[model samples]
Target: MVSRQNIIRVADFIDSTTRSWRTELILNTFSKDDAQKILQIPLTHIPHDGFLV
Candidate 1:
């Protein structure tokens, strides 16, 4: 399984890219039960560019 810090890092990347604070809130408060849902997201879809890498 991926680490929580890694997930938060992705969330931070998304928040930065979209300038959306909602990502921060979700990352900050996400529960263990929600992790599977987050994992379903394709991190690669954001591109391997520096922004989301």
Candidate 2:
């Protein structure tokens, strides 16, 4: 059972990382129940040299 605090932490981490990379993070939750559809997506971009390293 995932706790709400942990979920928020993960979301915050993802948001911070995306901001650092100058990208957008899109989160969508379908429902509020435990069986929720959550997605953390970061927009793709053409990585410069050494960006993937």
Residues 13-33, candidate 1: write the lDDT tens digits.
354455433443455557756
Tell me each candidate's TM-score: 0.29, 0.17
> Number of the top candidate by TM-score?
1
Runs in model 1 lying further than 4 Å from the true structure: 1-29, 45-53
Q: Report each candidate's C-alpha RMSD, comma-separated, in the order given.
A: 10.0, 10.8
- For candidate 2, the 10 contiguous residues with the lowest summed lDDT are 21-30
Q: After superposition, how far is residue 52 of candidate 1 from its true place, in Å?
A: 14
Summarize candidate 2's per-residue lDDT along 1-53 as a digit string, tens digits: 33344555433323343433212222222243321223334434433333232
